[model samples]
Target: MAIDPKYLMESYANPIDYWELFSKSGLSKFPPCVVSVAITGGNQGKESNPNLPETLDEQVQQTYDAYKEGASLVHIHCRCPHDPSTVTDDPEVYRELNRRIRKKCPDIIINNTVIGGKWSRNGVMCPPMNVSIPARPEVGSVDITNYTWSMMRKGRPEYGRPQDTLEEMQYTINKQELEHTLSEMKKYGVKPEFELFDIGDLQYLRDLIQEGKTDPNVPNWVQMVFTPALTYQTPDMLLAAIRHMPKNTVLGIVATGGCQYPFLALALILGCNVRVGMEDGYYVEKGVLAESNAQLVAKIVRIAKELGRPIATPAQAREILGLGAPRMEF
Candidate 1:
């Protein structure tokens, strides 16, 4: 369906739809928007995007650049020191990564993923949901539920080894593991960024809170992270999820493919923060791939500014997330 000249001319009437949404939603008065750059995903490496960092030095340097480009916090997923593409669940790996990143850019708030990695082993795809970091990250992710993706890793070199013709993959967020992971985070003073892919994940979290396992007094980083298997991907779906979410929390939106860019503005309009990078999306434009994580971050900063929302500093982000001071020096 080609958008002809006539259609284009008609579009000018409401050319900037985001403005209309913001004005109608009364989201003009927005909190400082925090931009979190996921430097690397536990499942992907240089194969997906050569610019994706594979070494500790690369990750730290890339993250430092992203910090300079207005990124307040960084979401980290470590790659193997030996292979640079493999994901490891070892606590030492997490500790070393945290230490190196801290030594380089001490001011950027650091977040660690609970997921170590997922790969096919012995003809079975193991979900790396069972993990605990000894490094004691300032914040960690807590994912809920799992979905089956038919096209998970078929001929998708980006998903895994291109040579392996993989089948259906079940990326489950093991409840038992999640409970343990959350307990560890609490033990180490790490706040969890509860990541919900479906609406049901909310009730699961509430149950945990009621059990006195979690503290509602602290502002939870409630993340509405989307997957390809998600039944709902529309803005209205997000709105509905937001309604069900606990009021005492900070909202963030993360989407894959090319949807990350649109969500950046939509989140701001709804008074939500944003997660952007090669992990969430690889493209800065329709065909242009981002050269670095900072490039993707800089793009969102511009969009937030255009909407009259200022970017939050590291200190502001810490306040928004109810986090302590920066753990290291820059």
Candidate 2:
């Protein structure tokens, strides 16, 4: 008997099938985009947003809620009770946070952030200093360019300072620094989530991949961080990133302010994954505060659905990212 087109079309579930359909239709390639919720804003806490997760229980609950709302991955930034504004290098906090979150949502991909900052009383926030991966989570971020990471400059008051007016640390991701983070991550088999701040950062990542520093066995996850200070947020800048984007690697974005809503829409059209939630921006709209991370994730899930793109399960996300079998479920 001849095959039924309806049956064939209805049975398609994976990203490749959708990709083929989009290509055949001559539309912009749209694939299943993985949703990653950055559980907490870098320094935001209850004091500022009141909705920010600071306590261990709150963090775990928020993460679980986000996962249930179709977020397959979570960017885990261990919280410290002392001050919700600065990151804690203490290994205990990282270990506890990772353990609890993993237990809470086994299938949800965990990506730990390695960042530190010195809060200046005078309002000139120092670049996040002493950045380290205290927790050996599934993945950690690796900055690959020279730039400043100021939430203020990006229209997000992470440091709660005036944008571009206060001085911040100039984060230079030199070879030595990259190697150090790599060494630390290797100790725990943690994959590096290389961040692209500009087009050059992409080229640098290419060099590392060629040098065997970034082994191909592990799925490379590159996050494009758009910022005014870095000058890599425009369509032309995105073109530059895709121009040098590495082969067979995951491409995602962390657009700050309310930019994620629009930028994610564009990135999805181009078949790129996404990162959202309070870490990037707390606004569900211009003046409103996000009640929870799940709210942000659901927004993206809805958009992808309307665009005729299926959502990937936790296991599929793991497989797409080349994460190991069994333990890392879909």
Candidate that scores best on TM-score: 1
For candidate 2, write residues 1-330 as lDDT tens digits: 222222121222344665575667532234456788998855555544778787778889999999999998888665556655655656677677778888888878788776322244235454342343545677777666766444332223554543434335455456776787687778777778887777777778778889888766655788888866565566667656655676656778778764657877776666678888887877787898889999988888888787766677888777667776434321
Residue lDDT tens for model 1, 89-172: 676777787888787777778888875224343347753533545677888876666655654332435444666444555565
User: How well does candidate 1 match the true structure, expressed as C-alpha RMSD?
Assistant: 8.9
Give me the overall lDDT of model 2: 0.68
- State the TM-score for model 2: 0.81
Off by over 4 Å in 2: 1-30, 115-134, 149-167, 326-330
The local distance difference test score of each candidate is 0.71, 0.68
| TM-score per model over all chains | 0.84, 0.81
Model 1, global lDDT: 0.71
